[model samples]
Target: MRLSTNQVFNSHVSSYNKGYAELSKTHQQLTTGVRIQTPADDPVGSARLLQLEQQANLLGQYKANMTDATNSLTQEESILKSMINVAQRARDLAGHAGNGAYNDHNRQAIAAELKQIENELFGLMNSKNASGEYWFSGSQSGIQPYVRNADGTYSYQGDHSQQYLQVATGTQISISDNGFDAFESAKNVSRTETRLDTAGPNGQRLYLSQGTVATQRDFDGGFRAGAPYRLEISGDAATGNISYEVYDKNNVLVPAQDGGVGSYDPTLENPKISFLGVEFTLDAMLKDGESESDYATLLDGHSFEIGMAPDRFATVGSSASAQITDSTVVDADAYAAGFPAGGVTLTYDGAAYQAFAQPGNAPIPSTFDGVSNTLTVAGVEFSFSGAPVAGDQFSISADSQENQNILNTIAQLRQALEQPADGIEGGNLRIREAIATALGNIDSGMMQIESTQAHIGARLNSIDTLTLENESLSVYNASTQSLIRDTDIAEATSRLVLQQTKLEAAQAAFMRVSQLSLFDRM
Candidate 1:
């Protein structure tokens, strides 16, 4: 193969240009601190840099989320801390009121203060976030979660769903929980039977119309004095009537039995009167006499025997005890007489359970606190079901992970506090219970918020590390691109000079060779 001077010069020029370009490019990278000026300079590196940039952007977003989480935790913690203080104040008030030295006026004063605390707590429960959303309103953050009704009861308007915050990849943290979980569900309320009979209760009785006036007597008149005897009533005429009233252990009439005011009947046949649990018929008293006994058949023609009147657990309180209410008063004597001893058995209201006892002699309620379900009399606990009560008072604290944190406990406390001490031994203890429960919840929620903040901080740290790493990778990627495609001005200039000299030299050489050989031979 023949080699031409032009070809040699062309090859050296190209080499020179590339060398100088490489050096200049290295200098430019050192000056600019970035290697990539364009994607064509390093295609693969450019692609990697793009990826790194996207990762960095996402990392920044993660950091922002972490910041938001931190702020939320801080806010929650502050609220919970304030709540703790309020609870403490409430507890102190309850303690002061519990002292036997305090009068109703003192109690009312404490209650007034407590009411203020409650109003403050209500505000806390319905607090809003920076976004104008109610913090404890669950999924209904835009609305006021609680409202005081005309009857002084609270009504919840928020939904029973959680509000979620995306804190990490595929991990959503719930920022709010339904009010029902924390407050609405917890209530210690006095419950009463919806079903009451018109007749006497507990099933005890025996009476019938005798001669002129009905006389209550033993089954045979001459019976063992030890056991209660049964008595019967019989009416001589078909139109004859008889009636009696059932009384409580206190001998108070709970229900009236004046079928008619005053009516005369000699031997009212089967003048039956239902008292206590048993039905007394006069026919039995004159069964042997029949027509002579002035006893005609009654609607049932059955004989009524009156013994210890079965067990007509008569009403103790006023007409109010039949319905559920915090203010319904239980008759002291009637309540006591109805009980095996003189107290009420409790049912769970989903929060704390409470017991009501017959009125005890107004000695001071105990000053000490304990947790036992039964009220002790002479060191013996009367039977009542549910959580133990230490003293007259007991707490049913809320344990919800959502809402105002004190909702359930607060409801329980309020209901118990409003109750009277008559049918409940140591009723004051219940007020204390409510305060204690609210305090416990406040403290717990505060700790939880702090813990959440710490965890969010850790996440922020991870985000920062990721962002820094992405930044470093981006720089390296840019430098690699500079190596692949930057121009070297010094090398390019040197190649131009060499190429010019080579062209002149090649022209001279060709001219000399042609003149010496070709001309002579021709």
Candidate 2:
């Protein structure tokens, strides 16, 4: 079979070209250090590599977020530590200012120092971060958190919304705390007062000791604001026996324990009365030359109110002027749980009174008794003394728990120290009370700051944990990606040498075959 010279030349050229192409491909793989340079080389492995790359990018972003969060939280913790030290100093000054031996000049010196501390605290509370954003400004990082008011009081302008940073997949951490919660919203020390609502015929006065809470949980659950318990006295002057009936804020009779009746023996010294987690002593201040027996008869219609002072109580509308006879809290738990933070408002439309929560004007379930002139709602009772016309409104506001800001506490202490106590009515007593309140409030503020610091610490720990996990995951991802996309250096190098040898043989054979042909054979 005769073969053409063109066919022999074409066959050798094709073999040489195929061998060179194989050798070039192996060399390219070795240079790039990747097994599959394009999707056509390994389609499934290329797709998997793309997924791993995207995951790695996401992990990198998460690490960046974690770092930022850590920095922000660390800054906050440092500021809070400084603020706590300032609060401790202020508390010490308050204790010193309360000394009765200290004269006006000494008090003035303390006041000056307190003013400086107040300013320092103010600056610390409004501290800025590395990015020039306020640390305690909630989500409004650009805005200042606390601002001084015209009346020397400090106001929190920032909102209560917290800022969060995503530290990992399906994980987020709070990076900022609001000023209101950290500085202005500490609980105040609980206290109660007793006042004579109605005097007896003989102008006799009922004396009551400061009411004290025996059980905090019970008190928080049972006590009511604006609602005072009523104490009525009834006795026979002849027998010199006095019996009392206690009524709660809801006007419901408080039954005696062990089925016993509430009785007061005037013969004994100042007797103690206990009810609803509160305990206080009761006594009578008689007129001149009057005996206990004579005062007992006059006390039949006398009544006294005992409860916490209301933050706000006012009657609105011009047509009808009604006085609040009694404002008492009966269900403290209900009020705390259901009452709006903004407060509540009651309006009378001539027939019945309607209760509405503040801010959004949401309706609250309330019942009004026309015969008793009482409105009961949110575990509190409001009693009116006069007739009301349509459009008459009554507003009663009291926080479920009282709070005083650290700045206000400092301002009050400074004012007390600066005021002259000489020859003023109850001036010394007022200063003492102010100092005591300041001390308590400062402690509360310190607690709040410490709590925030702890929360910041917790977030930092979480960031650390997430960082380690992210690192581990990154290592795993790198190993998997290497397996799928990286070249096996030893195997590729050997394959490249073999392809080179084969290409050399193909070239040599092609040269000899091209030279042969029919002319060489002749």
Candidate 3:
């Protein structure tokens, strides 16, 4: 068909423009080194590339999380190692202190060193990470874990919650542990104590011997059940005869092994009193020229408690001045009757400190003697030295006679070393008992630290494993992404040359053909 001049020109121009466009695309691909410049270039490959890119970004984030987790766990492991070493040193000091040849002065020197060690342990327990967050504070990262209360007792202020980091799909690692489990929950070997209020009629002194667990199984059962026993003396010393009655926390009398009342002779030395798979002796501290009558009067009407100790106590409100002096669960039945499962909350209304059961906020029968600064409630007697304002609160709860903190153990040992012995024999006995208890608790604390270290080591191992897995997946993703999104350098270069030649040929042909048009030829 014969074409008009304008139609022929339009056709040649269109051909040239198409060739140039192809050439320009090839050159852009070569320059950018990407096959799919837009989704229109290769729809399927572009979509796949997008997915691969997302996976690569996710892998990078996982890698970063693994790094942070590793660093945190490493710091914890190192701190725990240091704590173990310090505990070991303290144990050695305690073992040495138990030597019979060591005098009160020598024991005091050992205790001073122990106090330094205790300070070291305290710092370690409250250690902070590079971000200034407490390592053992669990989810409460910003709060300090261990704090010394005003009553000279150490308490764990952190909750038992753990923090985790996601390192991979379906894989989360714990990055922190609560301080309560690690530092504050050592097993208490000495679970019995003479009542702090036990005194003679004239306020003469008497101390109970450190009790022994005669039967492990029986004691363990009772301790786990929170079974508390009380011993009361009734007979007089005039006839050189003294009888004692054992009662459960409910105030019911317990029969002796021979199905009779237990008797003790004050004239005899260190008479052993046995009950509930445990045995201890009542030692009367007879003063110079003091008679047995005074000892009998001291022993009468006073009670000793077994298998009970304070577990956890805290004072609330900024102005609460009621420091807990004695929180031992003296009367278990009374404690259970007054305090509920959530413990008791004592609030001072300026006139008296009212007791209320926790969680439910039920009021409990309680009395606070303002003159003596003592609050008696739920079979627990709390002595305070400072005046408390209205709305001041205090909370205390007892454990199942199971655990004590490492700091308290060390503190007790230190106190024993510092205090003057009741007498030569009494002082030695007290020091020996303190040393034994300290050694047992320190060992228990060390074991707990080691367990935490092991857990950290396990988490680190998991991180290493996950890291390797993530790296492998990342490599695979990179390879797939390169195949789908990266340009073939050699192929793009050859295509660019061919497209350039085509564009030039199209322009040459179009120019020649346009010249041959009828108008141009005429």
Top candidate (lDDT): 2
* Candidate 2 residue-wise lDDT, 405-494, digit = tens: 788789878987899976564455456656766777788888888888888888898899999999999999999999999989999999
| Model 1 lowest lDDT segment of ten | 190-199
lDDT of prediction 1: 0.45
Candidate achieving higher lDDT, 2 or 3:
2
Checking candidate 3 for backbone clashes, the offending pairs are none
For every model in order, what is the number of clashing pairs? 51, 7, 0
User: Taking the tens digit of each residue's C-alpha lDDT, what string does model 3 give over 1-522?
Assistant: 977888987887788788888888888888888889889999999888888888899999999999989888888888889988888998999999877677778888998998998899889889998789998887998999887766566767778889998899888999888898787666666766655345456553555666755565766665335446666676475765667777676766766662125877656644566666666656666677778776656566666665455444544334545455655556768876665766778788878888888778889888788888888877877777676788887766554446777887888788888777635756755775677678877877788788888888889988988988999999999999988888899999988888888888878877787666356667
Sort the candidates on lDDT, descending order.
2, 3, 1
TM-score of every candidate: 0.42, 0.70, 0.77
The true-versus-predicted C-alpha distance at residue 341 of model 2, in Å, is 6.7
How well is each residue in 4-85 modelled by candidate 1, as lDDT tens digits? 6677667656755765666566556545656676687678867876776665566556556656665675676577557667
lDDT of 3: 0.75
Summed over model 1, clashes come to 51
